[model samples]
Structures are given as structure tokens and as C-alpha cells.
Target: MNKNKSEHTKDDNYLKHVSQIDQVNFLNFRRYLIDWYETVKRDLPWRKNQDPYKVWVSEIMLQQTQVDTVIPYFDRFIKQFPTPAALANAEEDQVLKAWEGLGYYSRARNLHAAVKEVAASYGGQVPVDKEELKSLKGIGPYTLGAIMSIAYNQPEPAVDGNVMRVLSRVFIIEEDIKKVKTRHIFEALVRRLIDQKRPSDFNQGLMELGALICKPTKPLCEECPLQSICLAHQQKIETTLPVKSKAKKQKKLNYYVAVIESPEGKILIEKRPSEGLLANLYQFPMIEQTKTDCSLLSEYLSAEYDTNLNQEQMLEPVKHVFSHLIWSIDAVKFMAQASFIPKEHQRWVDKKELGDLAFPVPHQKVLRQI
Candidate 1:
């Protein structure tokens, strides 16, 4: 209908500009980008090989996490669960423990589940076909595309936030990048622009360009490979081209954490439920409440832990930000002598034993005080 025609016209306009690049310039474009990538690409451990498992692990870890933070975690993760079979065979607690400090516990859980599927069905080999890869838990389009291009060298577009920003500036696509539909448009554009022979390098180059040159603020236009052909640069609007709406504000809540020490010098910690936030991780006794009064802590301890306690000391409130929520914790220290046997998910551990248990970052902070 009329809407289809309008969409067709818009695509035609964009391709018309693409068609304007002469064969020599097009060659130079690819050459400059790949050449720059070869010389300046970061010496990341994942880039050392075309191993699909390593690339898959790196891609999952890199989501919503920075490279500097992921490197050590990645090393330890691979060392523990080196293969699909290894991860699949490992216990859920082991997987979550490895992923303790790296927020987004669901990613680790889903990854563990998916790898189990791979072991069961695919014989520990990560699937290369897009549909099969998509069948795994937590493997979305962006992740599938990343595995396809980087690991299999397929001509698929790994259009993440970095790729979106780079392409938006280069082609001057003014649509709001936050819209889901915008992602499909950019994916198609990347499908056309991606180097067929070296799709891996091409996609990585775009990511690097966005991360380094075509930054969200203070873009280095002069050094960009596509500066000569960039529509945003020509229009002097590189900074404003990739428009994105602000994210929804995270819900804020106050939590009261109790650091209860036993007479035997062991600390009491509770395990989160098998589902929901911080699932299966260890944390000190905590209750979410609006008020910061210590009276609530005393009542909670007596009711739940079956030990009467007074807040002997109060520490500075800890501020922890999850993607969808913010936790301001008011932690207090208490000492108790009890004969009660530990619950199934609760235990008392000394400093040496605490080292082996997986404590989430928030509880890790409280542990330092004890």
C-alpha cells in the first residue's frame, strides 16, 4: 500500500547514496577500515583464535559489561567451564559462583542452561546455524549475529549499540535508535555494507570505530575511516545523528542488612531463592523496608534467625545499582550465640570457609566489615 511505497522510497534514497560510491572509493573504504583494524585493534584474548566456544563465551560475558571487567572473569570462567560439556556438567551453584561479581546473574544461569542443551543435543558443539543458535536460552539476535560473524565468519550483521551508533553517523540515519524497528533497518543496512569475504573483521571494525572514533560524545571525525563519505560528517552533525531516548529510571529501594556473627566466630548468611534476583547467591540477612530504623533489624533477626540481637555498630550505607533497580543498604553488626541447626539454604561460615562460597557484591561489601 502507500506505507510500503513510502518505506521503499526511503530505502531507495539511502541506497542511492551507497550506489554513488565509485568502485575505487568503495575498495578504499574497505581497505582503510580493515587496514586500520589490523593495525589498531585491541589485543583482546578472544581475538586470538576463531574458536567458537571462546567467542561465544566472550560475547555473552561482554553483554552489559566492560572489557576490562570481563577479561579476568572470562579467564576464570573458561578455566572452570572450558567447554559446553564442562559448563553443562557443572552445578548451578558452581556456575553462579563463577559469575558472582559480574552482575546480571540471569545471564550466567541462562548460559549454563543453554550449554547443557548443547551438551545434551549437539554433543558440546555450539551451533552455527542462526536458527539453532537462537534456540539456546539468552542467545538473542545480536548475540547470534556476533557468534555467526566472529566465530563462523558468516556474512551476518552483529548490530549492537556500537554498530548502531557507527552506522547511524556514517549513513545519517536519523530515526530514533532506541526503537526496535530501527534495529531491523540498521541490520539490513549492515547486511549490504558488510564485507562478504571478511565479515568478521568488518563487523569488529565497526564496533571498534564506534567504541573509539565515532564515540557518543567528542567523536574523532578527522581520524575516522568513513569521514570522507560520512553523511553526518558532511552535515557537521555527527554528534547528533544517532538519536536515542533516555532510559527509564531504575526503581529505588532501601534494604536493611544484618551482619550477624556467631559466638564461634562464624558469620551467618542466607541463600537467595532458586528464582528471582540474586538467585542462589549467598547474602547476609537483609530485609527491604522504607525506614532505616534499627528496630526493624532487631525484630527481623529474632523472628527469622531465632536469635535476639542488638545493633552494636552501624556502617556507612552501601549503594548498589542493578540495571532495573537501585539498593541503598543500611547495614548493622550484631553478635549472637545460638544452638539452632542451620536451615537448608542458610549456613554459618568463618573467613576461610567464606572464601569458597559465592557472595554477591553487596554482601561482599558487608563481609569486609565483619
Candidate 2:
């Protein structure tokens, strides 16, 4: 299903039940959700203030990524690109490098592209309205709703997985959660429930409820404040409220790197092809294999760099994990020749300059020794 562009869809008949919702009960649930939020919410830095830039960055990074994984990356990225203008004006390669290991390189690329336009056209201020926000690259319905409600105090609903799960259970929605129709139906329900007085707190509070209390597995139902109103909770069907298909397993790869170095302090690194995994990133010259060793590593480079690589110069094996692939790399060091040719795709840099350049995760690890 090509769910690439999700317009602010309005399914009137689908959400007819929402118009008749009991406001008093919804407000009680809202208060309970917010009360739970104040004490139990995760101590994320972005939540500390009401900056659109910070909230936008956090939302962008948190897409399809775990909260714990994004926390450190978010901290580091905000330290580097503190504002919309900072990120908007920065180099794309630098942004992607900073976004390394987070996966989904396109998010970083599209974000950079969109903000460049924002800086030029919108004076670098993130747009407040959902329509304006949607015009930017990579900013979809959820992102727009998030920025609108959380950053700008708009009374819109951000229907993410967590919120969907919680809402589906509260009203006992039985439709397939994977379908866009199901989510839109729920969003209309929450949109009217949003306390126009405190939309930010209300929306984030529901998100908070789902994340901490009504989790996907082994929900702390005892701690949930919406126990009285949640139909799933009363019926003991909370786990099955938001039904969806199983996730597809990511394919795995066993990649190896040959980190070769020369005697005079220069190191051999190659730029990855301009497409596919880790595209446009730097890596140590590599030898692809199902399995490998020092002997194979030496022979692989015989014609390319030099066979003068000493066995003692070789560092121990190193490994890195991407979502699908497992990369295993062995570092091999060499004594330099007086004059060696650099290939079109390869570069020989002063080893000390590795830090200055953006090496991918695996190459960055090999740099500690080589």
C-alpha cells in the first residue's frame, strides 16, 4: 500500500459516533491522562521547553526508531544544530554524517532539503499550521499534527502508534489499526477531545499514557488512570485493542572491511557508491566475504594498495550492526611506498584527519587503532 501522501482526510460518516461523545467523561479521562503525564513522563530534553525546532527534531528522529536509541542522538544533534536556521543552513553531508547510524538516511536528506527552503522562503521559522508544515519535505500528517499541537498549541490530534493503541482501546475500536481509515476515524475522535485550552498537554499526555502505562506488551493496566473509561481495560482486552499484522524481518548481511594503513601516517579509505546502504559515506577499503582472515585480507590488497602490509600492523576484528546487516571488519596496516596512486573512488588521507572527515560507523571504529 502506497501511503506516501496522507492528506488531512475527513471521513464524516466514519466518525459520526465521535460527534455524540460524552464531553464530561472525555475531560475526566483527559485529566487522568495529564495527571499521569506530570509524574510518569520520560525525562526527554525536548519536553523541557516549547520550542518548535526541538520538538520537530525529536519527532523527526523518533520516527520508526526506538525512544532510547533516539535520546542520545537527539542530544548530540541538538548540541550541533540547535535551531531551524542552524540545520537549514548546514551542509547536507554534515547533517547526514551527524545522522549516521540512525538509519533512514532519506529523513535526514529530506529534512535538510525542506529546511533549506524554509530558511530561504519562510525566514527559517518552522511553520505553525498543519497545511504549511505539510508543504515541507518529509513532514507528513503525524509530524504536522505534532508540531501544530505540541509546539504551536493547536487543538489537533497527533495519531501515532502509541496514541492509536491507547485511543483504539479507550473506545474499543475493532477495525484494523494498519488501515488509514481506522487511524483517521480515531484522529477525529481525539481532535474533538483536545482541550482547546491545553492541546499540547492533552495530546502529549495521551501519548505519555500509552508509552508508559498502556504499552504494547505487558501493559501496566493497574497504573493506567483511564481504567474507568477504557473499554478495553474494563473488558480485559487491552492487549488486543490495536490489532495489526506482524512485522517483516529485515534481511541480514555479513560484511567485512579491510582497514589498511601505510607507514608514513596516511590511511586508505574509499567512498561508498552513490546509492543504496550508507550511500555517500566513507569507509575503509573493504573485501566482501562470507568469512575472512589476515591471509585473505593481505591477498585481497596485493594488486590494489600493496602486499607490504605487516601481519603485526593488522588490528583485531571489529563488528557493527545496522538494522538488517551485521558488518565484521578486520584492520590491516601497511608500510607506505614512496609514491602510490590513489584510485578515483579511494583517497589517501593523513590518518590524523579521520576525525575531521565523516567516517561511517564501522570505519570510525577501525580508526581507534589504524
Tens digit per residue, CA lDDT, model 1, 243-277 = 89988999998888888777787887789998999
Give lDDT: candidate 1, residue 98: 91
Identify the candidate with maximal lDDT. 1
Winner by TM-score: 1
- Report lDDT (CA) for all predictions: 0.83, 0.77
How big is the RMSD of model 2? 4.4
Off-target runs (Cα >4 Å) in candidate 1 are 1-28, 341-344
Given candidate 1, what's the lDDT at residue 84? 84
Lowest-sum lDDT 10-residue window in model 1: 17-26
